[model samples]
Target chain A: MVIEKIKESRFTPDVFDITTFGTAFADHMLLSWYKDGKWSEPIIKPYGKLDFTPAISVGHYGQGIFEGMKAYKGETGDVYLFRPDKNLERLNKSAERLDMPQIPEEIFMDGLKALIDLDRQWVPSTYGMSLYLRPVMFATEEAITARSSNEYLFAILTAVAPNYYNKPLSVKVADRYSRAANGGVGFAKAAGNYAGSFYPTHLAREEGYDQVIWTDDATHTFIEEAGTMNVFVRINDKLITAPTSERILDGVTRRSMIELAKAEGIDVEVRKVTVEEMHTAHKNGQLKEVFGVGTAVVVNNYVAVGYASERLELEDLPETESYGKILKKKLVDLQMGISEDPFGWRLKVEENLVEA
Target chain B: MVIEKIKESRFTPDVFDITTFGTAFADHMLLSWYKDGKWSEPIIKPYGKLDFTPAISVGHYGQGIFEGMKAYKGETGDVYLFRPDKNLERLNKSAERLDMPQIPEEIFMDGLKALIDLDRQWVPSTYGMSLYLRPVMFATEEAITARSSNEYLFAILTAVAPNYYNKPLSVKVADRYSRAANGGVGFAKAAGNYAGSFYPTHLAREEGYDQVIWTDDATHTFIEEAGTMNVFVRINDKLITAPTSERILDGVTRRSMIELAKAEGIDVEVRKVTVEEMHTAHKNGQLKEVFGVGTAVVVNNYVAVGYASERLELEDLPETESYGKILKKKLVDLQMGISEDPFGWRLKVEENLVEA
Candidate 1:
């Protein structure tokens, strides 16, 4: 591994607003370059701008993929990452979708652990705050032809984020736009999937919604996922969520919540969830809660769901014994070492690398 | 307008290999920056690398759009662009779909004309070659939030290239993977739309095909378009093509071909085309020719098409008096100033800008 130290730390936690989600960056970033069909040793360098030719493939063709996870500063002065291996696996899946290169676990895990150990002080000690880790891979080859790039760049960047959502959200059922089609890259974190969603999500925001509840592209009848998270709706005391398909992301947070629900003896069903079923449940007063699960916000409850001209205001689940609340608490507790890691989801950062 | 001249040319036509598309750039490029809700004055500077922060919005979220066009060096030593105003109009249309700002025609047209005028020396005068111009706009804001970027960069890069495809292509009909869904960014030239297509196209390439013809996202019953072009099939003297909708790009070349067909008194129908109908036509010996229309390749006739486990071999139409050959010749002649422009589609560059 290669390392380059900065002359002085440009940021301190005191001056950096810890509540911001993705603005404040740490001192260094981990980077790896792939060229001539070979991967270089990972390097830790001062965070800065990257030089790019105007014809770089990613800026034009959108051959890019990314992963999101977090590192927590535990009470006992240890940093732990929840299922980093899972994120690494998903990143490679996205890479395959974009026809980009795959990243090995050696560089992904070892480099992350080393970087986190050296910058342990940057991790926020506050309960709500954690270091947000972003792993991004993109094609750097300079061309405009419709083909895969031969050169690539991979980087891991960290920022301090307290929480993504402060209150229950109001979401709109997507009617005019579709997020992912069958046999699409929805299962992968491809950059274009998010790009194609901005306009539709913007329209939903204009209609007084926080995000969009995307539906299957074919029929627009079955519920797919939320903006960037997997969704779950509780009706008649039963947890119902859409099954993972090619049009839906297999989220780590979503899987953890399901495991926690099963452990608590809650009836959870993973299958096709239709908008019509949701409307039927809401009318019968059986729909109790609606929430989304993702790495950014472990569990974000939605207080309302809107479909066309009809609106259904859900019960406020933040202060109740809702499934989302319990799952969030259990996951966070396990992450911060406040509770036992029964599922073996936590990996401790080893402080064995030499200081830069 | 601001102008920055280079000391010497980085490339010359004699040494530039026109066969290798998109690699050899001209001497200068035109660029414009958008910040704080206003566009800057257009600038013409030497073509080179662009400095970008790692957190640029397009790299993470895919807020990018682009346009493809060409400039021809006429026999009379004048440079002509084919309906550049149409490209400008479509660029703004694509921008609106992505929630990005619209570019005024003043900047788009004047900047392109000025750039071509300055670099007119690089325009290929050969019959089969021309100078390809690419206009691209992307979000340059340094943030990761799922919102529109406040900053943008628009650039026009030109490269010399001969015809993209010399031989007739063999394409596959997409059965599992979809290119664009209804009410998605397929109508617009969004970068992510192309990104989501790489994997499917790669799979087709592995099975001995050059491109894939997409189908409707809902039922896969109706045909949409080819990888980057509009599809046209001739059956019993009738030219059948799919109508442009939210799921299909309104290609300039496609529209031009339709007009030419009508001018020649050929019955052209712009309606829904189904895969089943095509197979029936092929079996009945009525499907005479199938071709793709686009700006890159004026008209690319397909030699064969594959769907599922079935293969349909088509005759090479280059020697026949096919509609595709006739349309290609008429369009190229009008572009090169060899024939009269009846539709007023050509824009000649003024020789007022400083030459290199």
Candidate 2:
């Protein structure tokens, strides 16, 4: 029988209990501070709300960065992190964009593993459920100089979730507004990038769409990622997705899909894709499927896309959201150490973590 | 004597009295929600913590907007707001970009006035000091969806003694990065627009400069605002600023400066000014002064600039910085109702506002 420890997570947990959000915290969270021109030694402590100011640059100015990953429950109850290095790498990229000092990759990954190991049992056994991990960084400085803050705060939280997507999505291709430009933060998953899209995405939803697929700013011709996911467009016999730029997020799932496609000997074209090309292909019976891939949903298949006065309903693709099911199964198996580690992905969670 | 209100803000007064960041607050805060497809009635209630999910659309998607303004204390203890209608108008424009419903200008302005009138003692009177008002709106819906949130929270707060600038600035004409693009939300003062520039601004600061004058995204030719303030460049004799675009924030101070310039017969030209033109003028001594005008600091004059690798020393034009100084004094006098209201810009506070 699994037993829960009474004391706080001192080093690691003898047992774990499942919970959602940041409510159920591991005993130890990795923290490091930078001040007077240098970063300090990292410390691990209990999860709780760190003191924050309303004037904290991150709170008001939106100088915040966050990364989300999941720890999965295998049949043997071993927790595992899928492509954690990618999340850490992306977090650093975001930190750089926000003028935040980046935590070394080794420290970032090491911190994540330590936190997960201490809270491994929080990983749910439900097929779709997992422990959602969030690593966040923000300017903790009280000054409102409208310049880069000198001090910052970084934190990690966990949430147990069944799925991010409710069902198959129906999105709209934004033909007028743009999420980012050539020299914007669209490439980084910065806090402000997400906040800017709120009003537009609200408008798109009012029009009865799930989300808006943002395009290039100058000309809304090239297709970009849906607000939450990098897009994958499958035409007949070929998979084509827009190549990322400074205005698009560098999604880890996007890279993984490319590797999976290449391994399957499928031709994957990474280039600019125009909406007109897809509309033409749809009319010519060449458009096969369009879906989204991200850490949240793995693959959220799209059934429809509304653009410029017409709704493109993709029928005969999969009555059910297909790619998500197939890819998710493969992804989970690969993450849980039960599948052929073809890509050499997945970091196994330590089974017996001894607390001091 | 001012009486302290109890349990009014979400925080205790001591939080503000002793905190290093914006962790403290006054008792009461305004709450206005947008639900049932429209904005709800505005309420002033206790300021408190808002419970939120990490996956909240605002947290992930960045569905947020904010406005910055201030209340000034006159020599006679009367309170005044400086052209607050402009902030309301800009907030609406930002709301439209994010697809959030607009709060009628009267309602917004009324709410701000009521808040200040109720807490007039919070308004400090130190020179170069006043209560800095921050009105912000954010997505509050809890879920993992890509579209905008159905619910939102709009509130206002104030900070005292914000010394926004400390020294003369060294600016760089943004050569590689752009703040906003054509047909983008640049003019709206949307939260994300500022978020995107933090890193690039940091990069500029690291290069021994204070801020970067963002250029157009399509072509990095025309000079836009200095991210936070509108750029006013004096070429020998004339005042030149870039014409506003969809990506350039239409600063209230920028417009007011134009009006003030026209009143003074300064021969202001609101058109595209290139980095090359600036370089050429600097080499020939045609460049006189470069300063920024905004709510904070009022005026931040630059003494130098770097274009690619060439640096321009603009200290010779001592006259342009003086233009900002004189204009700042004139604007302050007008706002406080101590000077001529040639433009009818001041909105005087209602008498006995605290009686209610």
Candidate 3:
């Protein structure tokens, strides 16, 4: 591995804001090239522009995939990553679906740990703040053919993320626009999946909704995802979410939350939740809460859902009485190294991984 | 517009092969930038590499769209483009669906004409050859957030294309995988739509098939597309194809073929085509021919279709009796300037478009 450190530090965690969460980055980034069926030596260099041909495959064919993760700074000044292995595993799964090459475990793990350790100061020590990590891979071959490229680029970027104090959202249930098909790349974190949702999400925002709750493409009858996150609904003290399928992403935070909720003696059901059922539950005064879970925002509670011509507002609950709030606190505490991690989800960053 | 002419020419059309069709390029390419709520001056520059950040929105979120076109060299050394206006219109439609900025008609038309005229020497005069044009647009902003980019890049690239003599394809009818869904971006020429089909097509290739015939996402009950092309079926003396919908691409060549076939007094039906109906037609010896139409290949005949352990071989028809062959010859003749165009689809290139 080659290490090209930045000449000067640009680590300004104090000024980091949520609005520009991913705009600001750490001083260093990790890059690797795939060519001739093998990966080149990984390099950690200054975070800056790259030189490539405009004809690169990803620009025209969209063969790109990415993963989202974060490293938390504990009160003891130690940096830790939560479920980095899961992110890596999901990245390879996305690569397989997009017909791109798989990244080796050593390269992913060693490169990530080394990069994070090198820029450990960027991991903000402020309460409820952490460093957001973006691991992305894209086809780099300069060709115009509608096929997979022989060359690829894998990169990792880090940014200081602000504390997310998300307000309850008003979401629109999709009746026309579809996010993913039954046999599609939705399960994989493919770049195209996210881009395809932007126009629809824009429309939802125009309708005075914070985000869109994507439903099945075939009939638009059941909820699949809420924007880019996995959605969960609580009705009469029972939590239910759509089962992970080819049309739904298998989110790390979603699975963790499911386990955490089950551990707390809450009834958790992993099954398809239909829009009609939610509307009926709301009408019967049984719908308690609805929320989305993802790496960026651990939990975003939804206050209202718009289906057809009706806007069903959920009951407002205090933080102490809200399951979403309770679960997010428990998850955040474990991630920040303030609580016991019975699931072994946290991996402490070793400062010795890189040479001083 | 600024013109950065190449110091030397690399017009080697004689040795150009079909396998390296899009790999080689013309002398120059057209580039335009979109920033600050408007487009910058377009430039015609020498074909080369570009400088960009790996954090470009397209590399992470896949906000990319493209169009395929061809410039034919006439017998008298004149250049002609087949329906360039249609391509530009479709490109903007694709842009709108992807939440991208709409490309103005003048920029698209003027830039294309100037670029083709400047590289007119590269247009092959071979009997069955032409110059392939790729107009692609992508999000170029240096950001990692999953939203539409504030900046974009639009480029036009030209390549020497050899004669396409496609053999009869053996396709596998999809019962599991789907290409698009209702209210999706399938009708637009979005980049992600193509990448999502690579894995399924690779699987079909492994099963000794040339391509996979995509079906509807709901139940896979209706055939939608054959590989990346619009599919057609001839049941006895009638030509049938699926209508343009949110789940099917609005192919230019597909529409042209339908018009030409109708002009030749052939009955055409634009409706849904089901796999079961095709099987029934084959069993009754009523299925006559199956073909695919697109910008590339013009027309590709299908010899067999595999569906659920049954490989149904289509009846062989001579070129004289094949409707696809007749329509392709008429279209190619009109495009190559060998025949008088009655449909007014050909646009003659004027040498005065660019300065000497």
Q: Estimate each model's TM-score.
A: 0.97, 0.85, 0.98
- Model 3 chain B poorest ten-residue lDDT run: B12-21
Candidate 2 stretches greater than 4 Å from native: A1-53, A105-107, A318-329, A354-356, B1-60, B99-111, B114-129, B139-153, B315-326, B350-352
Clashes of 1: 0
Q: Ten residues in a row with the worst lDDT in model 3 chain A?
A: A12-21
User: Every model's DockQ, to 2 decimals?
Assistant: 0.71, 0.35, 0.80
Q: Candidate 3, which segments miss by more than 4 Å at Cα?
A: A13-18, A163-166, B163-166
lDDT of 2 by residue, B66-176 (tens): 777878877788888888988988888888887777877756887788878876776655455566777887666654334557787777766653456667788888888
| Candidate 2 displacement at residue B41 in angstroms | 8.5
Better structure of 1 and 2 per TM-score: 1
The most accurate candidate by DockQ is 3
lDDT of 3 by residue, A206-315 (tens): 98988889999878888899756899999899999999999899999999999999988889999999999999999999999999899987888888899988999987
Task: Write the residue-wise lDDT of candidate 2 on A1-356 in tens digits.
Answer: 11233364432332234232333444445666667766666555655345433344554566667886888887877777888888888889877876778877655776677667766766776565677787777665655445667886655566555567667888899887777877877788787776667666777788999788888877788899986799988778678888888888898888888887777576889988899888888889877788888887778888898878898988645433344345556666676667877887778877544364
Better of 1 and 2 by lDDT: 1
Q: Model 2 in CAPRI terms: which quality?
A: acceptable
The C-alpha local distance difference test score for the whole of candidate 1 amounts to 0.85
